[model samples]
Target: MQSTRQNSQQMDESDFYTNCRAVYLTMFKSSLENITSKEQLCTVLQQAGRNPSQKTLNKYWGPKTSKLNFDDFCEILRKEKPTGRSELMQAFREIDVNGDGFITHSELYKVLTSKGERMTREEVKAIISVADTNSDGKLDYKEFCKLFMSTTEVCQKRALERMEADNKMRRQQFGSHSEGFSKSSLSHTANPSLGTNQQAEMDVTPRKGEGKSSMRPSSARSRRASVSSTISMGASGGSKTGKLLMPKSVQDWHHTALKGCFFLEEDGEISSHQYRLDVPQTSTVFLTIKPMNLSQVEEKPSSWMSVDAMFFIVKDHEDLDDMRVVCFTELREKEKFGWKGELSSGVYYILPFTTGCRLKKKKKNIKEQAQLVCRGEGGKLALTKEFRAALSDIFEVIDLDGNGLLSLEEYNFFEQRTSGEKCDEEAWAVCKENFDTKKNELTRQGFMDLNLMEAIDRNGDPCDLWVTLESMGFNRALEMVEACPFILDAHSEECKLRLKAVNLKQSSKVLDTAICKSVMAKGEAKVMKGSESVTIYTYKNDFRITSVIANKSNQKVTIHVNSEQSKNCLSSRGISMFAVEVPPRSNVVCQHVLPINERQEWIYNCTESLVA
Candidate 1:
């Protein structure tokens, strides 16, 4: 077997700190700012893909050498005896790049991903979630320490504490002439030809794909190699170490178009949609249903089916009626209904069905449908370390509750969101039987296992896995090897409905829109206020009830949903109490209010609140 560990040439203190200086000189607002202390330099080194140990970093930028925050920083270092509170308080300030009292998720994510042992995005999110007492997505100094705690127990049992003994010992040693750790290196002869040490090589693997973030310092130099600096920490070499060390995945956006197709059984004409996927190997298949009109004959503007359609990714059979559904999309009002499941290359059918005979959706509403599209991406997300890391991020993204356990209901939401398939009672039971679970909730391991099972069932052909990781909003821009994304528009026997790409769109102010007029036309609204940022719009009718929650803020918001107000109402997930997370300025169908009996007045009085 090949060696799994990666090896790279190591750098000495001069190279390491100079590379650190390279990052500091580049990403900062001004190129002149020097790396005067460990705190400032540590964060920069993270962006540069160098994670030195405490002993190592301290050895390079020691207590005596650092000019941290002038006297304030040095006072703590000099005394080495600041109280635990003071030490942590100081640490928080250094991490706060903009000097903002709170540390934002993006900032924290950047620090964690670049500096430490590679972490799944989920791990970092969990850390802040503990200290984010206000549920505002950012951490204040106190919350930061509380989340970091293990000793004082002032906050929850998870509180972090610095030892009083350690602080006192460091303070008592403020004696002899403590010299700069870098003094020897600084005194060495200066080299004028290294040309700024800009090309220093680190182990970060660079790819042409979308990096984690797109936020680049406009003034930063282009990608170069061999980063080196003189004894003086003047950065000269340019090392563009995958510049996307920031918080966001800017490449995950979609190029969307409005697509239309007819159901298989309409007016007994037997028209259906089928696409061939003759993959030379196993692959991934995912698709989304952002919106579909329920209108027949004349397309009514702004309408969702009275009940959503059943979509399927099925084995393509010569007879449409005999097709075997590989996956199912349950009937629900989920606006972001999609799939990200693995598939072997073969012909398949993308089937959509409702109970109605013949139905027609006008082109007028097609643009609106396309504009409200669930995002589609992940053309090649193979199961590499990157894929594993991506899955960890996905797990955290779906873990609406910070409890670290994925309740069956939460897992169900994940299922429906990723594959439009609900994790029914039997499926949930099977999960508990096979994978790790806690208190009937899927642990992070189980969540991973569930996804792993999909690919594993196919004997682990990773081409499929790559496609599976490509997009969270699984929808129909699917393709095979060397295939460009296209939509097949066809007309059956005698149906007059036409299919065309009505428009091309990017973003939608979908959440900004007021109560969907179509939703109002079908049922009465049940208003549930979670926060100023999130609004849960519930609509009730005879058979079932549905709710859509929208976030108005720039931060990802989690709102707990409670159906207790409805004496006998249960959500489609079968749980009356599960939280839903709404991304910033986005809306999703959060709940499907199912009724125990069809004859009763389906009282869907659901309530919600921001998770704090």
Candidate 2:
């Protein structure tokens, strides 16, 4: 078989070359001896359908302006010829008449038959069956290339060469053993402590109470140095104990706080958010208070001091949490806190007079909480003025009928255009039930009430932009979003609201219940609504029966399966035919399993009596 294939390939190549030489000779009309000058070579090339420039012809003729011989001309033509893949791609595109990224069977058949190739429909189907790896019943670019190039010796040789080069590269990267270099080997190269002698000794001798050593001496030395530095610093600072000193007035307190000193009161309101501190004698402090969790504060509180207005106290401490209370003028400013100016640790109490009315915290209702959780992380939902305005603009655009409402159809079109997929059914159903007050369509008010950003959350946690981007199949867009999160914010004032509205509409469309009936259903089964019971029959010739049962009742419905010719298919699978509960307003697929030759007549009975 191999020898026959090789001979066939050799014959094809020889035939190709023969056709090429015949065409060349016919176009030139003169023998190799006749062409002597650059002008003559240019004339012959131009006659052969290649308009060679004077400079290009000169390069071929050499610095002396000599003419090319017939052998050199043939070699140049061979080198200039397009590769098999390129030619195949061109042919594939030509055959793909509609340019829908695939060549249909009919398209291929028409193209082939028009070119004088005679073949039956079955023969064409057979060829496609071999090439269509994805089983889509069409020839994609890969399938078309494979079908044409697999038979060509040149393509096969090129493929083999690529495979060999890839393998060689893999071996070089992974090494011959394929185990890769150990962490110890990498650390040895990075650290200067691991000299050649120490590395050699470690390789020869295993450490005490160790089966194998993955850590090099250099890594151990580096770790010890770090530990010793930390210990020495602690020893030097720990000897001197400092006392808590209180500031005379709020102005003094503010000055000390600006110098990176914080004071925490025992009974004061402590939260992980921003607050306005209005000291009676000092300027109002607009700062964010970050309270350290117990696990983070290793050192015990040295002393607790009670001050009336505010105070500045210092101690020898490096840990941010050791100060017991830390405050930042801004969120970004918190990153600047470190053991820099003075080794500080202490808590100061402040009782500030109100400059104006304090901001009130509004209690959120359950519905609002659910929406907020969906929109932002950690229940922190604050829509910028620009973002809200953007949403309003989007809502106006989506209201195509201009009745201040978005119908289901309009919503679906918007979703299809934005996310490329329908919104999830369960999510849409929830939105309609909760946000869609009229239950007819999404009104502008209803749309605004929905947390569209949260609706795309797949994991039901806080809204994640990356997850949303990925779900929408915007992978490259997601990378850009990661690099610049503010891009979403920057563009939010324009299309953010529109994007969310589309998301909500998509969610609604995806959840709309539509049943899929068995394709094999003829007249054997009949669907009838009864006051107490519903009965369905399966065809006698049907070896398997599939039916989609939707529960329209307020409560769950259990389906009872019965068969006359065989054991209950549902019962055999350990499912209770009498107690198969279908959730309210949800659809369930009921299928009967039987042997290929076993044609069973079955009946499905559902009634109020079967409700569970």
Candidate 3:
């Protein structure tokens, strides 16, 4: 068989551009004037047996150069044709079986052994390791071409060496046999007719396409030559040593071979039942958990469908482990979906079906719904009698000073003692809003009217809090209070203290407006007393407290700032110092920061009380 080097040399000598130029000119009818646009040029190229995408055309005839003359067109063809690589790509595509643009171990193994070659698993792995640069255990077009080109070079060199060796051996044997026959006396002793017949046999040569003559040697040398011929035939017939390596199974190719399709049923009932869709042997299937009501059924699918849940099912391949079913929840509209995790072999009622989407209208008021759900069919008395009595006892203890009405200071003291930390001022504010009466204090009756304990019990249930929050327009504070009743008391106490310290009346029409502006602007507000002002900035997870203390008296004042929260508040400079000195007629600013969960009560006192 001819070596790859020889074949390449032949191809080089065959005037490739001459043939391409002729084809191009023929497509344009011997003129290039009418080929004005890139689309026109692509058509001409395709008609001439060249396949190119729009991107390929743009690389040569770019957007800047709209028109191409004959000379430039021919020049591009010569420079960008990729003759050898194109042939290699064609062969690769043929072996790629599934046409996934990647050559998998199975496809490679099948193609290599199709011509009677056997490959082991380790050998296949070695071949893949060489070209699988991404470590994905598959060869893309570029990698496959690189592997094939290298193998071809090696095969050519080996074939050339074998041919040269065979030629040398033939020469040595011919000379030795000729010398021995010339010196032998057997020819003289034999009959002249017999000698003539032997000479005639020696002079006759085998015809083309016929087997080697019977006169050839039947020794080790001849057997080696036969084996070399077989190897050459295998190489010439599109077989490569690298192709014999096959991966263990199809799983190795799944990362590239697997594809998914998602489907949603309109007005489908949500149920806790297993649904099955027949999957293709080598494909994956994904189903979106969207349950649409009749009102939402528009002529065109809206992008706002609640895709809060989804699941995937993969067909079994080779091993049972390849078969997977996974479900995911807490998804949002237009959020990219993926498998949550591997699920066991059982029926799962995913999302909309179990949530009864079709049976109910789209929720318009989430907070109201959350409240109703939390109340349940058991009504407001969801708590047991013992739990209710325990709650009443707790409330009585918080009503400090024996006033029947719980003042903000009393509530704050109660929370500080119970939690063993400083009060969460934000939690206190929320409690005040929900349970405080017209007097700006939480009365026993007002506290019970809120049903704080029952709300907490309902919020702790296994219902989806994310969906509830979404319906409620994401009222995080309300959600937090409902989930934890202790926050209500804390917030209420904080509110009472703020109003009492500021001496603001609850009956004032401007009270709600003033509090709303400060709280709504940044979820926090600053309270000033005497010559000292404190602003607390509340975040989702932490709080920043900024304090300014001014000394109006004609003497220096020493201010002490201490955090009652569990987490020690750090100053802006990262120090734990709480005491700072202020000069006469001057002010001092001190800032403290801590995480929300670590917060307790905070106290600020001067060496001498300042007059308001």
Candidate 4:
């Protein structure tokens, strides 16, 4: 059920009208009397991070005319829309009264003067004049096709005229108050979405694990509202895109994010995603992080452009600095930086941070953004059996004197290389207390136990563990691994360039969206509630276990997550409390539950709302 006014008042610490106005001005920048259509309503839904199917959108949409205002946009979203097709397309089919696959002037006049704006005879004739190509004073099927699509050479001529007319009308209607961009200009073609005669820009933003920036010709992006307490970073102008050829197992998406970041204005957060790379045993992969710049895409477009971005790889809970910095380059040097040798397996994070996207914000500075791309050769994603075998081999190598027990000197030699810390007598005593030991020396099983403890401490992060394993001489036989969820820090100033995350779990319109969308492995997604105000999407991947939450409401929804069932979750080791605040009708993978072993079950509970 919807929150009552008293609940709203009690929950909201700020002014209620301000909240109302914020919701009111969600679409068209003003809700007062400004008309919107189904297409524009779809754009608004996209801005809120939803890619609902046409059928789903149609169920929620009202009116085929440009009469759906901001209030209609609000009310339609708040209500439950069942599965259905659009009545708008059906309306035209009904207009062809003779069933001859054509519409006549009499039919058009009968409908135009009766429904919607009730156009005058002159206006009806004007529409017929654009569609009737044969000069027969009647519209055939081909002529009717011209009304909806202008992709053909014959269709473009008349459609161009109609589009220019619509542009002129839009300029006159909103005038100085609007962004002043023509639909044709934004679409880069004369074939605008037909029938509604509304303006919409198709979103083509970057996505997760991406690290390149591209410039678009459209300049109708909104300006980013500057934050007074913004943290500043140095970035150069002009970035370039690079190619990534990595380990074979998980090598599906390989594009750098366009030179921009996803910035959530309300939360002051940026977009960050993870890409897993598997380094094969006994192989060294040469890789590079390529930076990109904004290409000049417009003669006099109305927005700024991104020219640079940043990309790096790290283990879970590790920062860019914590991992090795192979090669670092600024704006000018767009060349491939350095050669990559070997990376330890087990959940490495590839973070691409782009800034200064032009299409989303009207920033005049036009600062260049950074672009990052990664490429690697073929390598199998390591499994637990492979790791155990490799570790067993290492134990043999470490027991050099033929004895299976590790003495203080032998263990200290290992301790110094992986961590640079020598184990003292007290520490050795503690190790003996926790692990299998014999005659005050660590046995083979004890050594494995010691390493297992290290893995547990890092929440199963394999970077340090692999370092220890490599030092003991086993980097040649096996490589990296899977397990544990990662974090995504996405930041786009506005909706257009947000490169919004897709909830692939939703069987809706998404394939047509940008590349690099989440690749949730095939599994049954247990949805808690129906497609109502709240939804939960779970994915089961041997590499990473994650969950997505979709909020199908107008106002912000706070979700409570309880992981009482999954006792072995590394992040908590017990029940965890999480509150996630989701935007209206948004889809986001919010939970990162990391289970310890193959036997541990991953379960999570819910609570209050979560806002980010």
Candidate 5:
């Protein structure tokens, strides 16, 4: 029996070798890349039911831990899509601890801790709590998977919030000192009737700790005491060492005080906000004030201050840029901060500020006028200079060979370094074959070459492009598209249309858009509501005027254009601007020219009447 088993194993090994050679020849039609091992290749053959010896497999695939050939197997599976989501789920369940439909928080913690997570008990508990959305004492498997899948989003939001809070605190502390000078100067200006001599005397001298009263002179100099206003030397008037008189209003203000500052527009009035300052001067002078909280309807005190007015004494022209000045709109509480006598409120920005130098507005054609000058779509993006500088700083990291455009090989190396995943050389080679070989180098044009819309446009023919980015995951590629100039900040009709095409073409799996195109209608569509009108258009000439579609259950009809048309085109049977005046159920179709891609495909779009 032992001899027979040995013979059977030998026979299986021979069969596997023959099958592998055949598959390689049929696919690459060339010799495989340099190889010192055959283990993974043998495993594939065995998995395909062609038997092979363990020794033979090891020779082809190297050590099991190498993962080089395993990556190739995965690459083959991806191209074939041999198994779907259900199979992947089953594989995932093999490692899952909980028997419940999903993985659990405790199970994850156990696995990660066993894997050597460098965290403390409390830290682990905190992280788990955040993931356990159901708050049923533990995280369900679905929740656990969600947490793992969106790790990038989770970490980004938390980091952003923490940085914003830290910046806010720093600005408040620093601004207090710098803002004091301006507040004092503004106060003097507001009450200018007090005579010039008094103003001159006020500017007499600067002393240490000039703002905070705690740093004043000692009481031993009482003999030199003069008028009460001369009490700058010490707590009491001069060095008299006498008890100081205090007003009830001042005491009330201090007791209810929430220490902070606010900014106001140059032409804005602070009276509506309600609080008043008796001594709104530089430093630590007491302010006799009243609540501006809406609940306190009194008219005497205004609550806010202008940023310029408060900081005029200390600020220069440069400080005006990239500065965020906030005003304390609410009073402080033991546990939470809120407005005095109001339901709930806190500090907010008084001035709209950016984090870096602002850009001067660009003059453009009248037809290309942007709606908003700053931070608006198609408008000059905020801090363009800063963004460019940052990209310059990190460019070297991505440009491994410093040749500028990242070659497929160089990009694969980058992916492994940044994503902890290795590329499947076979799959990558398959994808590379689809690119224009004449280009030779992977330039921006080469990347855009993969864009289905671009492919259709260049060929002047419409067919679904099915190229894939092997090694680079769908999410990573999506990020690159988002940052690209053609996609980011695009708002015009043409740009928006192109953006949609890019999005549809870059989808992870092949999409079914034939249905979307078949349903399109041709010609201009007119819609009318009580007082509104709208226009509808289709991408291609194939669409016929179909009966008006209206009043379907809650799912309002939206216009669809041929996947190839500019993304933002109007469509027949869709709610474009022309339908604004058309009433739903009042069916009407008009014949007119409609734009189409090179393929002559279009989809129906509803008019505003559908919305009505």
Candidate 6:
């Protein structure tokens, strides 16, 4: 969205190169120092299978253009190709600020400001402080080059020099100590006569009148003991690995309060560091504690429960005991009561206090919600896209007039179409029969509302002869029917459904033996009868089927069709079921309601004989 501007508008080439060099040398000191020649560095990169550009190599070499001594080295580096003139000019401008063949901090700040970098006065002062080589409040060209380059080089040089000096000192000390020991050993070995005289003299004791000898072994032992004590103290003291070692005073304090012996007087300041409390069920209580930070609670101190309780901080907030205290435990012990329906995540257990306070806790160690649902009784079926498509096909079948949407009548037609079927069909019919009968035809949106509503009005009367799209002064009911398919398709598979079917008692009856087949795909089902003028029925039920019927010639297929409805009975017309080949292993079943007045013998005869 934003265009990148020129080098000067951002960072001048020279300044950028200097900064890159500084960072590179500071981070990769040995590599930068050892690889003196540009060609050698390029050779190294080539050996490593790298091909860094010349510009990148020059940038890592620091701002050498301003330093006359490095000019030849820079030229040698660029022998492969001539460097860009604009970049060299920018480098020159950086060194020769004010166009007076000299550089200064004011000039640098001006250049940075011109490039849209707004460095404050203090920041400018800091930059100047770093760049001031002579410490004379300003910089000349030569001093500027030295200071800029030294930012990276000086720190490394100082550190190396210090290491060299320390090594030299160590060597000198070792040599001198070795020579002193050799001289002492040589004198003892070469003069046994003197050694015996010395031993004899040492064996002699001072006279009783003599003052206390200065070289007493007792004094030497005391001095040696003191030195050993100091070493031990120093070893155990000072910083551990550059961090102040755990202060003994603090550790002792903790040990004394937590594990150290304490005399508990009646009301003395005994460290009440650990305690447990039992809470009653459905009861509220306030706990008081000594005013201290929650972290100081020594009872199960590592549990985050203490931190969770801290959010209720007040002048006198009570400390929580260990997590062992379960509020339900007291209830179970006393009243033999326990909560039904276990707690779930995203649901919190609130423990209310008598002081108008509460604590919230997430349910711990619980099975996931999805797993819980899966383990539910009867084993819930996964509501997948295919299942939803089936429901949409059923919805579209009911929206008869080929309208783009469904009215109450169209929706009811769907319900009625499948109401008389069995299994899921029966379930759907039982659930939605009242829904369909209560309205003429539900609009697509209206059906959605009814589906989402928890309950239906029981007392309302049913509507009859609902207005079609044409009657409603809309486009043809075909558009409405078209719209119904989409809405049904959109229905989540999770939506509970029931499918039902009806059949005649006679096994050989036209509706009994003939099968109606529908093929479903892309959320819509087409019933496949050989002819375009095939007759289908829409009962008050929720069953969906789609098909593509190949013509007798098997050349073309017709997709959508509206079936006719039967009165006071379920019927499928124009049984063009020749399109379907029945599998030998297929099981066929039929269900229908028994007339209330029918004799038990008649009902038995009707179902048993036909089913058989």
* Candidate closest to the true structure, highest lDDT: 1
Q: Estimate each model's TM-score.
A: 0.23, 0.17, 0.15, 0.21, 0.14, 0.16
lDDT of 6 by residue, 179-201 (tens): 44322232211111100000000
lDDT for each candidate structure: 0.40, 0.33, 0.35, 0.38, 0.28, 0.25
Q: What TM-score does model 3 achieve against the real structure?
A: 0.15
Candidate 5 positional error at 199, Å: 57
lDDT of 4 at 435: 94
Q: What is the lDDT of residue 185 in candidate 6?
A: 32
Highest-scoring model, TM-score: 1
RMSD of 5: 35.8
Candidate 3 C-alpha lDDT tens digits along 1-612: 568775564344233322443444444533223357888887666544455655678776643354665434544565565336669789778877788889876777776555444556676777777777887767897767776666655644554344345434654564344344323322211111100000000000111122354353221121112100000011111223212122244233322111111121111112121223322232322223332211224675423232222332323311322322233222222322222222333333221111111122222344442232234475643543433444464455345334567666665544343332444667657777777564777787666654544356566452333332322112322221111010000011111111111111111112112222222233332222222222222211112233333333333333433332223333332222233334444333333232222224322221212110
Candidate 1 residues 1-612, lDDT tens each? 123221121223223322333333334432223356677756554444344457656754643343332112221232332136667778678889888688887887887788746667888878777777788878786666654443333321211112223222432331111222223422111111101111111111111122243232211111221111111111111212211121133133222222333321111111222233333345433344433332235745223333233344446444433445565433222332344456564555444432221122111212221111111264432234434455664565445444678876556554543344677888778879999988888888776666666665665554444444332322222211110111222211212222222211111121112112223334343322212334445454333355565444444444545454464444544444444445545555554554444334345555455432
Any idea what lDDT model 2 has?
0.33
Question: Candidate 5: lDDT of 187?
Answer: 23
lDDT of 3 at 297: 48
User: Candidate 3 local accuracy as lDDT?
Assistant: 0.35
- Error (Å) of candidate 1 at residue 166 is 26
lDDT of 3 at 328: 28
Scanning candidate 1 in windows of ten residues, the lowest lDDT window is 192-201
How far off is residue 552 in model 5, in Å?
Answer: 26
Q: Which stretches of candidate 6 lie over 4 Å from their true place?
A: 1-89, 92-98, 103-107, 113-120, 126-143, 146-156, 172-612
User: Any runs in candidate 2 off by more than 4 Å, and if so which?
Assistant: 1-397, 417-430, 436-439, 452-612
The candidate with the higher lDDT, 5 or 6, is: 5
